[model samples]
Target: MKAVLGPFVPSYTGPWLAGVDEVGRGPLAGDVVAAAVILAPDRPIEGLNDSKQLTEKRRELLFEEIQGSAAAWCIARASVAEIDRLNILQASLLAMTRAVQGLARAPEHVLVDGNRLPQWEYSAEAVVKGDSRHPAISAASILAKVARDREMVAFDEQYPGYGFAGHKGYPTKTHLAALEKLGVTPIHRTSYAPVRERIEQIELF
Candidate 1:
């Protein structure tokens, strides 16, 4: 993991290099939440890699450490309705922009995951596997993922049959089966394929 963090070492790079990442993009329900994290150059963290590579316990531990260590950090979300309105790509961009804008100190440079950059005024770079390569991006990934998971767990309590705690709103087979049995809920993305198909079937019936 140290080797992964080497290239992104902040040494005199600027006041900050904010790394941004989002979670819940592919979920059939729930908001897309993005996190922007600015790590202090002098105090780099160890065991920082892509969030998906870590266990849930490890991610929770890192989430606390990041909250304490970061110079500026924030998470923002675009709701399911917004995702339907803007499409996932644009909604994710909106969520990222909100996360960056919410930061107490504006970053000199923005490092984002994936190929496309957001329309923010700040100078930015998009790395294909940034969450694995960049420390700040990895940290943001953990924050966003952990935060979204917690929200899904809570939703599971409210909507008992959906199994949100298990699949976290993704289109797993169990989730698809549940949709077929229970039908659409308010939290579901009406624009998504699975939900749309179910709606059409009901309409035809």
Candidate 2:
């Protein structure tokens, strides 16, 4: 689909606007991932949208198409340790900054898919729900979400029973139950209230 470009989204001939988005901030385990996508002026991928709005199959399809068509794309992450050390918002912004820095080419402007912009040198704007308003931001959201979901699947293999693959470490009923039964894993964010409560419960008992 043609991008839902708006006031915040640039329609310039130059494909120099990099869109950034992050995923996994709410997860009690694993890292926060972010992606920056600079879409090509000549190449337009139909059905580009917010990753959360797309089905898994559609996201995977667009993920591949985005890889082949985008002018530049990069994925980066702040680990669980960083999440605990820096708070989720700061950690998410850090991941976004890294994603932008890791891009193959520098962007003239950055559009992030949220209300707050990271502290970065680049000219940037924070758009509320930019993922649905801008194609590049949508692409970035897909990449970050898909990449982090895949990481959670891998984490499931290493740390079974937490249902990382299913819930992706979110504070689901199953995940909280597992945390109570199994105690906190090293990947779990101890700074989180639920995880901390579980840890305290274990220590108390």
Model 1 lDDT on a 0 to 1 scale: 0.91
For residues 1-205, could you state the per-residue lDDT of candidate 1 as single tens digits?
Answer: 3333235443336858899999988999999999999998777778988999999999999999998889999999999999999999999999999999999999998999888889879888887788988888999999999999999999999888999999999999999999999999889999999999999999998
Please give the distance, in angstroms, between residue 69's alpha carbon in candidate 2 and its true position after superposition. 0.9
Best by TM-score: 2
Instruction: Give candidate 2's error at residue 188 in angstroms.
Output: 0.5
**Per-residue lDDT for 156 in model 1?**
95
**Residue runs of model 2 more than 4 Å from their true location after superposition:** 1-8, 11-13
Q: Write down the lDDT that model 2 would get.
A: 0.91
lDDT of 2 by residue, 1-205 (tens): 8655464536443669999999988889999999999999899889988899999999999999999999999999998899999999999999999999999999999998889999889988888889988888999999999999998999899998889999999999999988888888889998999998888887886
Q: How high is the CA lDDT of each candidate model?
A: 0.91, 0.91
Candidate 1: misplaced stretches above 4 Å? 1-12
Q: How do the predictions measure up, each by TM-score?
A: 0.93, 0.94
Per-model clash counts, in order, read 0, 2
